[model samples]
Target: MEYKTILVEKRDGIATITLNRPEKLNAVNVDMRLEFLNALDELEIDDNVRVVIVTGAGRAFCAGADISTFESDPARIRRNLVNLKREPRRILSFEKPIIGAVNGVAAGEGSQWLLQFDLMVASEKATIAWPATSLGMACPYGMIRLASEVGRFRAKEALMTSKFLTAEEAYQWGLVSKVVPHEKLMDAAIELADQIKRMPPISIRTIKEAVNRGLEGYEYTYQAAVNQQLSDDFKEGVQA
Candidate 1:
């Protein structure tokens, strides 16, 4: 599918999706959400693409949801929220391993988005934060796997404090596999993808499936978080 909010490129058994709304720091809006789902659909069935890399253009990986889009009709808001909620499951269950080349700030829902990836490669300037509590929403997707990645105490502290972790700090906490210079973020991601592609496809897919098996049970929690989008507090927070 042709995309406006993202650029899709395929080469050497790998596909890359670059979030293109750099002017807004690649903050996701409705169009980006729909286009991303469509792009995934296209890539999923392509036999030549063994791995995928997700990154953002310009200064930020993804600053999170475009709040301006949040002040919409109630029903539309619920529908959009529901659509967004399905993304985590779709990504987690994908057959090909995904690497997040986090180039810059990845905050709020952006932080949650990275958690769905099989691996994360951060740039030296990258920063990650989960600010959902301050925004009056529970990040069920993020909450589920964060403790598994970084331990319960650290995850709780990060979530509650809503502070950005530097790339080195994130690496130290085991949130990202490695941190490279800003200019080499995609190169590092592509190198990892190359290594993954060299492995037996079945073995890689099986390993990913086994790792994500426990995450499937969080669907109910995700549903509950989506429902929170309809609450007055959430609306008030958005409007503020």
Candidate 2:
């Protein structure tokens, strides 16, 4: 499927999806979300695609939900939650490994996206943050995922404080699998995907299934996020 807001390239059993709104820091607006999901769906169904790499076209992996789109229209935001059909669990559902090449700062939903990747390679210049609280919004999945990654205390500090984590710090916290110089980000991610592609496909898929099964409730958590879009805090936060 053709997309206006994202780019999908497939070659040698590897598919790369570039969030293509660099001028907007690749923020997730309604159209971008739709195109992103379409690209993901296509990649998932392609037998030629063994591994997927997600990165941004320009500076950010994703700046998060573009509040500017629906800040004033709570009804529009609510409609988007239902119509966008962007089930976060879909990322976990893909049998192939999805590697994140965090080329730059990942803030808000962008940072949240990093948590969904099966593996991550970040640039030395990359950073991650959750500004949800400051924006009067809340992301419980982020809290859970962050806590699962870096422990409860550290997650609290990061989420509550909206602190941006540098590449080294994120690696130390176990959120990033590897960190390379800014220019090496894609190389590292593709290298990792190459390694996975070399292994037995069944073994790889089964192992991924096992790991994801161990972490159940993704559906529940994602639904909560949809519900959150209707909250007064979410509306106020976005408007603010």
Best model per TM-score: 1
Candidate 1 positional error at 155, Å: 1.3
What total of clashing residue pairs does each candidate reach? 0, 1
- Please state every model's RMSD to the true fold in angstroms: 1.5, 2.3
Candidate 1 lDDT over 1-240, as tens digits, reads: 678999999999999999999999999998998888788888889999999999999999999988877754667866776787778888887889999999999997788889989999999999999988787777777877887789989989998888789999999999899999988988999999999999998999999998887775477667766667778777787777
Residue 168 error, candidate 1, Å = 1.0
Using lDDT, give the best candidate's number.
Answer: 1
Candidate 2 lDDT score at position 123: 93
lDDT (Cα atoms) of all candidates against the true structure: 0.88, 0.80
Each candidate's TM vs. the true structure? 0.94, 0.90
Q: How large an RMSD does model 2 have? A: 2.3
Root-mean-square deviation of Cα positions for candidate 1 versus the true structure, in angstroms: 1.5
Cα error of candidate 2 at position 145, Å:
1.7
